[model samples]
Target: MTDPLQDPRFLQDPYPAYARLRDAAPVQRVRTGSDGLHSYLVTGYAEARAAFTDPRLSKDTARFFAGRPSGRELHPAVSQTMLASDPPRHTRLRRLVTKAFTRGSVERLRPYIQEVTDGLLDGWAPGGEADLVEDLAAPLPVTVICQLLGVPEADRAAVRGWSDDLFASGEPARTDAASHALAGYLAWLVAAKRSTPDGSLLHDLVRARDGEDRLTEDELLSLAVLLLVAGHETTTHFIGNAALALLQDPGSLARLLDEPEAFAGALDELLRFDSPVGIATFRYSTEALTLGGTPIPAGVPVLISPGAANRDPVRFAGPDGLDLGRDAGAHLAFGHGIHRCLGAPLARAEGEIALRTLFTRFPRLRLAAPEQEPVRRRTRLMRGLRSLPVTW
Candidate 1:
């Protein structure tokens, strides 16, 4: 049991840990010393998928935290997201907003996504070479999400700042500050939508709230915040990771560039090769149970590693190899079963368009510093390059 977070081995390539854990102990108990945090790590694809769909494994931590010393309930604002609840609450809320996340709904915005992507590309100085991350990856998705959620285009910068803060799990003080800022901003937006409804996802959610009795006001606010933050953050990393994967593999990148119609298969491989959300959100135990021969006590927290599952040898042949033509629809990058990410289609479209357009625009693009491996974010929950410096 090493300090998984600080262990460089886990950082550089977690596949070894996943390989060992999957083979020897798919479910292993881990203790957090004095923090009083005890949990299980589910590493295998089948076991992880089962846990994902198990009604006994609750996504809502509120029940588990009851009478506990955790300060989670101290901030009612943060604990009120659909991701933190189970059915019928989770089912109801997800259904109410399903229209905004459908494949058809997201595809309708493809033309707009292209326009947004191309607009950002137009702004970049090709030969001068800019950080593909900042110049393109970050802005394109932010713009699309802002426009979709009805956030005023002028407020994109501020919204992005808040999102960065809320998802910053590394520093305690920073995470708290970001949480407050993001929550405050979302509260303001939710109130505005109530008074003046416009045609956007936020507006549709607000209207749905009036039309249905399933979601409460707080639940609606939390859902809105989740949609905005999760919507952009996950896709942001996907764009960066996917581009890095394709660039690192010349054969795959060249094929996609040579045949523009190959975006679909290439996108799947990119997702499987380097997932953006490296970890599943959180699920708690409902009752004591033995999983993969490891005993998990009731009410304990568990973190499922999706990135590891994507590379599971049992599930993928040459799991580490980049095969653009392989069938990758079974990849767990989007989690399996009912709780799968609602924004999958939107993310796929954005990733495909951004990656294709990026390479097409600058075929000679190369890392600004070839000697250094790109630094990744410290959070175990998400995988993203801290900064990607590039030149044409």
Candidate 2:
């Protein structure tokens, strides 16, 4: 009976709801507010981990929705990506992407990430107020992703708007429109790269071929859209979420500020304390299976809550509290199994650079109005603040 999406408290701070779910019903069925879709919400750390790698649960939406009128059609842009496929297909797609998304590839972009971070911070005058989400968190990752994808600066705003709509809730028609628009745009972008390639990941993907295996036109478009949307959105929220966490706990913020070398470990704790992607993408049961002693019927949709699992007290001592020194290396913030985020390295680098640089530039940074609550994003797929107003 408890609907997390309908509850404002849950949207604002889901950790309490996650705690309740983990204790009472680790695997409980709930209907989504937007489309009334029924799904099993897994909250326990162990349960979520098992579900992530479980072969019984499937990511192939086409197979799961077969002969079912799911209202809207599954756009190739949505269905053809590695996020929506099973092994062999997912393996091939991931292989091609991994070649370009390697740690070294992302490491090469560190200077650019730092440059963008510094430029954004430079606009914020010391002892003046600024919206951290707008001036820093949002634009920093967007610029990095746009540059990496070879997206023109003039088109970044439009692309960001489309990306927002794709993850938004409540308006099914509007969401469809945005999805189509992004897919169409990526299709054109892929074609443009064919004639004159840019030395970007999109270009590398366009040219990627493995033993006579090449990405189809639709696959190329879907992959590009995925990279662009997923690559930026995760990091954008991460910076905001991490910054909010630090701002609220001056002790931890001070520790990181005093010990610059501690940012790496502190970043992991921040991710565990509040993940950007609250829930992993949808997965369906291929056959009846048991998760945390609860039986899931065949063909039922399952949603693994990384946000909840990361805060499981059984897995983490004093999980609700954020300890910068906590060993959070095993957190499921970037997900688990074969479908883990490909852009995690890039996101981690961006978070560290953005947080470190922002604090260094404004040592006395604090929330503009500590009494006022920050706005939370409405979508269940992501957990992030809309804006974080701050001043020094």
Candidate 3:
């Protein structure tokens, strides 16, 4: 069976294929890799929501990879973050990390976010062409995350480079190398924070507490790596994807530019219409179970498609169109369950500010190559554009 998820055409625009998959069943079994293994994708909104919290599907990476030799030795930072852990430990990590990574922390970043956006836009002149991905979309979040996390100015470019390589798909060697490099860098950052305490979020995280239960060395290191990698990569693409959608829809762009406040609600629709995280990270079934009424044997790998589920016609009216007016709050752009992205509020704040500000300033913004298809990156887990060249 062909893996629709990896097809180049499907990557360009996946909604049509997703609709067909949803029509076939709420859940679809498909070939996910070249290794001849099969995985279940919960594509319907309801099933996807359920699968997120299903106790039968364990997110523990050690449990999933036990005895499965792949010749890759992942760093603890790569293998043991909140994304890869389940319960009790997940609870503790989230609790401690949350103490430092608060919504208030995100709110404090708003002024700086605006400043960065303005600075990036300044690089391009009015009535000129620019790659939105490079000029505004990519740099905004990367700069903002480094600011929010208190990463030093000296290491910002290196940090961003490592994150880009870490998330670059289909390059296992580079990916593994990035994993160790980032993990090692973060380990040093953590140690530096301990000896010379600073006022940054990373320092706070190093000193984060939960009734005297501190994050162990591994937990702290992994969480830092997670925040650094997960923090900026998807978001760079998210701003790109959202900005591209608006460029293609002048009417929608006008609505946002005309009324800045409208973006607060419209961001959800944008997220659902073109999810940043196309598919939730993989998890393996802890035991045999029935999901969306489909039975699966114990230990089968599973994936949840936010891209497919968020656009199911039954759940969303005219799922293909971009409707900022629709109540899109129920969308699963951020996975539902305890493992939901911790950086979600921050991402929303950044997205709303990024999109609203970009169009508001560049009122005549448009695609540079309207006749050619947009180039999407080659990764199913995170759907984003490679570059969104535009002119105003």
lDDT for position 84 in model 2: 91
TM-score of each: 0.95, 0.98, 0.97
Q: Note the residue pairs that clash in candidate 2.
A: none
Residue pairs with colliding backbones in model 3 are none
Q: How many steric clashes does model 2 contain? A: 0
Best first by TM-score, ranked: 2, 3, 1
Ranking by lDDT: 2, 3, 1
Give residue 56's lDDT in candidate 2 (0 to 100).
92
lDDT of 1 by residue, 284-327 (tens): 88898877677888878888888878888888899888998889
Summarize candidate 3's per-residue lDDT along 25-110 as a digit string, tens digits. 88878888777779998889999999998988999988788898977756778877888988888898899999898999899889
RMSD of every candidate to native, in Å, equals 1.9, 1.2, 1.3
Give the range of the ten consecutive residues with the poorest summed lDDT in model 3. 1-10
TM-score of candidate 1 against the unseen true structure: 0.95
lDDT of 1: 0.80
Regions more than 4 Å wrong, model 3? none
Model 2 residue runs over 4 Å out of place are: 33-36
67 Cα displacement, candidate 3 (Å):
1.2
